[model samples]
Target: MWFRRDLRLGDNPALLAAAADGAEVVPLFVVDPTFATAGTPRRALLHDCLVALDTSLRETGGIGLVIRHGDPGDVVPAIADELDATSVVVSRDYAPYGRRRDAGVADSLADHDRTLRGVGSPYAVDPGQVRKGDGDTYSVFTPFSKVWRRTGWQHPHPAPGDDVRWVGAGSTGVVSDPLGERPVAGCTLPEAGEGAALDRWRRFIDTSGASDGSSRSAVAAYDDLRDRPDLTGTSRLSPDLKWGTVHPRTLLADLDASGSGEEGHTVFSSELAWRDFYADVLFRQPHSAWENLNPKLDTIEVDTGKQGEEKFARWCAGNTGFGIVDAGMRQLLATGWMHNRVRMITASFLVKDLHLPWQWGARWFMDHLVDGDLASNNHGWQWAAGTGTDAAPYFRVFNPTLQQERYDPDGAYVERWVEDPSEPMLDHRVERTEALRRLKAVTGR
Candidate 1:
């Protein structure tokens, strides 16, 4: 089984399929050099995850992950040829780069009379599964979510049941670090691996008996307290989801067994739906990864010169003078993660207050977030810029002061991150007007 995103063995459809016929499975992971672009936190977390996967394989299946270093197109097929394997199995990847990489690997495998079989994906409902009656993708989230719910998803496959034979890394004829050295991440990352992931999820949904001494599940209060950065009201599970330590199907199944009718459960389910929706959008329009999904917004004026660079540098350093924005940026710098509400606030500050391109902020985020996925990060930036599939209207600019007063009323979140914030770089009122003027100039709205 070729492990890419799906690291955990439990509920992994592709892994189970690989061992279905009682085949001696070789658990392989290629360390692609291209992954260097991922930020340090992500790189470090990935190393821990790989080590954890190896541990699980050793404990349960009497084997370990085979570590190879190179382009997957060459490494995968070469490994297959060496093993004389008939087929390689994997969970499908939907991002532009992953898709292209998989296609190349498939062709290379065909040359050796081998096949690459894709059985499942990282998402509960794979991209392109939910569509309108006309079979076209949904442009808006609500309609797409409704169809997605109706389309539903399969129950997660159990981990391989049969005691299967295995190929050890020593016999693979390739050698690399079993537990790779950790990259130097600037901030403290959560514990990495499948056990950690499952533990975190159980605590979030209150499935685990241990609650960190809290009376309520984080999910129970998610709808009410999720907006507050001061409290631990959110799941903090994005990193796990990004790494595929626990599948969305597993989460959904747990929610189903719990009271699915609760508002918190319903709201959290919708959040997962947003993840699927963005993936679908990127799957259909790969260029939307960096380009504006709505072409009309192409003419929207943004700063890209020295002035913009200075402003962006200030934003990146968390010195923007706006308490809430600074706090959010600092949180990201410190933890490689930020609260969802603050993400929107900081994004709007960049696009509307400082008049910078959303792409700049998006790139910065992708360089920093441990949980960053291309479809979610880029399309989310487009949503803030009013150039993606959502109703984040360009006319509705976020006011940083009002936002701080509303979301961080006690000033605790800002205080936690910002030691001494500077004066506001630009007045929200002035920039809000300038932003609307630019939008009107582009589309005559």
Candidate 2:
């Protein structure tokens, strides 16, 4: 069984089906060299997740995950040939590179008269599954959410029965440290693998109830608290969900059982739906990963010169004049993640204030964020650039200082991440005026 984003063993369709076929499973993990060339923080996180997966499989009496380093198009077929395998089963992936790689592998396996089978994707609801009554994709979020809710989900399948046996391949004897010698600086990652994901869910539920004795209680207040940067208000599950450490069905089932009030659960569920929405958008329009989602906005001018590079560096280095923007960037650098609200604020500064292309910011995030997902990150940048489906209008720029005052009221989040802790906060009204003038001048608006 080949694992990509779907890392967990429990409730995994492909792994379970593969095991059910009654053939000895050669569980394999290939570290694609192209992935290393990308060298993003996610690469390291993937390595850690693999280590956790190997440990989990060991406890279950399966052979350790075979680690190979090469282009999967070359390596996967070579492995199959060496083992004389009958079929290769894997979880389906939706990303551009993933789709291409899988196709190549399938063709190669076909040459050997072996089949390559794909189970369902990582999402609970496959992208583009839910649409309007007219059979067209819903572009706006409100209508999309309504239809998504109506389109419910299936109960996740259990892990395969233990009767499944394994076939071992002799170790490739390649000593590799995929995640490097140590974890990234300032990143204290959560425990990884299936056990860790389930444990975290349990702890979240327990602590949420400890104060109110109701699973739904915390959720009822989620909408009110989710925007606050200083509080641990949002579920810190993005990283797990991004990496497929936990299945979305499992999360949705828990939320459904919680009975969190209509508004709160509605809001939280909508955010989850956005994940599927972006994945669908990417699958259908992969070029939007590099260009504007709305082609009309491709004409929107951006500064991509030395001046733009200088501003981009400032933003990346967390030295932007805006406290909220700098704080968010620094937080991402330090922790490999940033609060959702801060992400919007910083992204707005990059596209609006700095006048740099959104791709620059997206690439930087991809390189640093452990939770970085291509679909989400690309769509997020496009949203900030006013070039995505349901995007904020081109003129609706975020006022960073006002955002700080509103979301970080006491400045705790800023103080925690910014270097100059004592600098007087910039005036939002003043900064907003100046930023607007700069943007207008650059775009001839």
Candidate 3:
């Protein structure tokens, strides 16, 4: 079984498919050099997860995971040839790059009369599955989310049985560390591996709310507290989901069992729905990953000159002089993670306040964020920039001071990340008017 995003053994459809005929399953992970562009926190986490997966495999009476480094198209077929394997099983990938990579691999495998079998996907419901009566994709979030919830998903697959056999790829030893000797980022990272993911999920969902003698689970309180940056209100499950340490179905199942009808659970489910919504959007319109999904919004002027570059550098270095924006940027720098609310505030400031293109901020985020998934991160920046599906209106520029006051009332979150914030880079009043003027010029509104 070839592993890409899906790292865990449990609830893995491709793994089960690989072992269906009682064949010796080779747990292989190809280290593509392209992934090196991801932030150090992500690479370090991947390394840790690989180690954890190997330990799990050994304990389950399987040989260790095979590590091969190269382009997967070349490496996968070569390995299959070496093992005389008839087919390669994998979880379907919907992202543009992944789709292209898989297509190339399949073509190579076909030349050798081998099959490339794709089973389940990382998402609970694959992209393009949910649609309107006319079979068209929804450009707005509300209707898309409503249909997504209705479409639902099947129960997660069970882990492979003990009868499944594992074989090591030690004989064809060309294995090399994908990350090489590069240094990981200095910031603290979340614990890696399947076990850690499950533990964290349990803590977040509080299967038994009474476990901690609290009347409500974290999911129950999620609605009220999710917007507050000062509290750990949101589930810190993004990285886990990104790496596929835990499946979305597992979380959904837990919610269903714990009374999903409750407001808190309902809100949390909607958050999950947003994830699916974004994936579907990206799948249907791949170019939106970099270009604006709403082409009409493309007319809005964006700064890309030396002044813009200087401002971008300040924003990245967390010296933007906006308290909440600075805090969010610094938090990303320090932990490779930033609160969701702050992400919007920072993004809005970049696009509206600084008059910079959302792509500039999006690229920076992809380079630094541990949980940065292409579909989510780029679309999120576009959403904040008023240039994506269900985008926030261009006139709705976020005032960092008001946002800081409303979300971080105690100023605790700001204090934690911004020990010494600089003066305001640009006046919000002036910028907000300018942003609106630009929008008017484009839309004649």
Name the best candidate (by lDDT). Answer: 1
User: CA lDDT of 302 in candidate 2?
Assistant: 73
Worst 10 residues of 3 by lDDT: 170-179
Q: lDDT by residue for model 1 over 254-334, one digit each (tens)?
A: 775233487878888889999999999999999999999999989788999999999999999999899999999999989
Query: Candidate 2, after superposition: displacement of residue 238 in Å?
Result: 1.5
Give the clash total for candidate 3.
0
Once fitted onto the true fold, the runs of candidate 3 whose alpha carbons sit more than 4 angstroms away are: 169-179, 207-214, 257-260
TM-score for each predicted model, relative to the true structure? 0.96, 0.90, 0.95
RMSD of each: 2.0, 3.4, 2.3
- Give, for candidate 1, the lowest lDDT window spanning 10 residues: 207-216
Give me the runs in candidate 1 sitting further than 4 Å from their true place.
Answer: 170-180, 207-215, 257-260
What CA RMSD would candidate 3 show?
2.3
After superposition, the stretches of candidate 2 with alpha carbons farther than 4 Å from their true spots are: 169-186, 207-218, 257-262, 419-445
lDDT of 1: 0.88
11-116, model 3: which lDDT tens digit per residue? Answer: 8889999999789788899988898777787888778788788788877744678888899989999999988889999999999999999999999999999999
State the weakest 10-residue window (summed lDDT) of model 2: 170-179
Q: Candidate 2, residues 270-353: lDDT per residue as tens digits? A: 788888888888988888888888876666567898877887888898887677788888888877888989988888888877
